[model samples]
Target: MGRLGRQDVAIPDRPSVGYSLLNMAPKHVVVIIPVFRDYDRARQTVAAILRCSVPSPFSVRVHVVDDGSGDGTAERLSEQFGGRIEIIGLPENLGRSAARNAGATNISADLLLFVDADCEPSDDRFLAAHLLSIREADVSMGVVEGQDDGFWHAYQQAARVRRDRLARRTFVAHFTTQNVMIDARLFNSVGGFDEAFKGYGFEDRDLAIRLARAGARFTIAPGARVIHRDTLDLAQVCRKMGEAGATTSQIFASRYPFEYRTLGYEAIDGQRHPWRGVLAKLLWPVFQPWTQHDAWLQWRLVPFKLRAGIVRIMVAVSYLRGTLRRHR
Candidate 1:
């Protein structure tokens, strides 16, 4: 019931006042969660952030960007949090890149935190962790840990962990956009997220890669974690994979030409189980144009069966287009 600081937000009781003050700082962190269609999940994410047990030397101004959601997400947010949380409702459906840019444009904070609507910050120190990292680096990546007990969840978690491992080691450039913190000044200087990446995939990776290439200091904050609720059904998964395939080629060609040229997509073929690789190759034609395909291929160096077929088709199309252009 006790209001903490000028924000007038209630801070939960703690036995040790000094411990509560450990992570709190004078400057506040602005957290932005971009939402499109998932109102329920987005609302839950904001609630989780509000409930987080972080210290409170300063209060955080959380922004929920509802990117033209048909769901009453904006109304619910206003009714529930009202002045405590700010809601930005877009008239049209701008993709994640655009929504994030809009959210960042309105936020004036010492540090900016970008998180997906489906993810929740792990603990109070999550913001402090980012601040520490930002003091030394322009951008910092937080780990998105998923609980894997059920069969489907286990499978997905295994695959994601593999992707994270690759990101930490060889492909550090492709950090997950689910939970990341960036210096507001540097983000603006880089022109923010590229709105050209209209789809779901590659936009975050593109931004990070570009920043690193431009000599922006990049580092990982292992302690700052977020849990991503990636509960996509088979059909939804395939649809997302298809979108990945479509955007990945463009992403790769623009960002990692050397990697593409050197190892090619063939690099991931032998890394995973034989059946999974074979199955992916078999489905390539069905899922190739999707964004996830590009991600899977880039990190795993293997192809989904349907996506591979689509990629071949796309390759043929590109070849034909190139020939026509040369002729003209």
Candidate 2:
């Protein structure tokens, strides 16, 4: 490990890189993990990454962008890691998009791997798989195994199975920032993430759509996997989902109206589904309690299928209500 260093960085207005699909051999890969006050997890991930084994002809540097933790977490990480990883401490809480954009300052890096702070690489091959995947695709999205419960746990875990592990380079439509790698040039060509996304939610999806539009190919790098440590209850999930719906849902819709409709956002936020919002409000009492552990409708009593359905409805209601509240 080298001596501790703090990197002060700035992104210029509308910077573009000349991207080449032919040269997929990466000489340098900068793993950017944007974190907000997640010190323990960040340290663990960075340490694990530094320990990982990589293929020859390519080197890995971990870049951590502290997004307004304001808690000296970045400095602490710098102290612990020394010069093994680069740490950028932003003065204030910039949204996720801006924080990630800040970490994309390594102009010499051929690949920029964005891994959420809460995740840890699954094996030694984690970095190698991502490096290998981009040889055939523009963006290499990693797989994940998680310790979670309730709907989100099931949903995230299910995401891993959606693409067969056998299909290493299986093309995927959806994208998330949790564990994904993209060509540095291609990411910059699309202006990186749209900082307009204030909170969480569609920022990753927004970037994915832009990347797709720019002819960026996506693949599922099965061997490149991580252990996602996020675990939240129904209410917590609702809160985050609602935050997304309230903050970035409309931004996404206004920017991509056709995608908004095609994605089923039209049904709830659309003119046709006004009654669904009202219905959700009317039934809020019955289902809202379910968010609490001791709610009348206990998950233990209810059948698995019905319980899943109820949980799904509760979340949808929270999200839709949030989107509707924007208009009010």
Residue 242 in candidate 1 has what lDDT? 44
**Model 1 over residues 1-328: C-alpha lDDT tens digits?**
1212112111223312222112333366788899978877787788877776545454678988999987787898789888979998899898998888888885566567899998876676677676656555556778787644343344555556556555433344336678888766657767888887886466776676555544455567888888777654334455543454455435554466544333233233222234534555565555445534344433234434444444444433332222222211
**Tens digits of per-residue lDDT for model 2, 24-61:** 56688899999999999988888878888888888988
**How large is the C-alpha RMSD of every model relative to the true structure?**
12.1, 8.3
User: Which ranges of candidate 1 are over 4 A from the true structure?
Assistant: 1-26, 53-59, 168-174, 259-328
Best-fitting candidate, measured by lDDT?
2
Best candidate per TM-score, number?
A: 2
Give me the overall lDDT of model 1: 0.60
Q: Distance from true position, residue 46, model 2, in Å?
A: 1.2
